[model samples]
Target: MSKNGSHFKVLFRPKAETFRGGCGECQTSCQSACKTSCTVGNQSCER
Candidate 1:
């Protein structure tokens, strides 16, 4: 499979939400910034 496909699998598979949610404390601003960057199509937050 391609790199994109692998990413899709990991992103959409069950239990993925565990990794998606921010750490709440340390991730508050950082997650927001990452989400904003992603919304603009930057996609730098994929990792």
Candidate 2:
């Protein structure tokens, strides 16, 4: 039997999935909508 708490267990997870790459009109619209562009492609080359 395991004694791990639910709250603690909830925090553990596998690698987060990357955003779907869509460099179309929809993506452009979303970028414009956001106050600060947070997407990786727009900001830097590393990731």
Candidate 1's displacement at residue 33, Å, is: 0.9
For every candidate structure, what is the RMSD over all alpha carbons to the true structure, in angstroms? Answer: 8.7, 8.2
State the weakest 10-residue window (summed lDDT) of model 1: 38-47
- Candidate 1 — which pairs collide? none
How does model 1 score by TM-score? 0.19
Measured by TM-score, the strongest candidate is 1
- Overall local distance difference test of candidate 2: 0.44
Question: What tens-digit string does per-residue lDDT give for candidate 2 at 24-45?
Answer: 4342444553566565345422
Q: TM-score, each model? A: 0.19, 0.17
Q: Which candidate leads the pack in lDDT?
A: 1
Error of 1 at 8 (Å): 50
The runs of at least 3 residues in candidate 2 whose Cα sits more than 4 Å from the true structure, single-residue gaps closed, are 1-7, 12-26, 35-47
Give a tens-digit lDDT track for model 1, residues 1-47: 66666533433554686557544454234456765675533333333
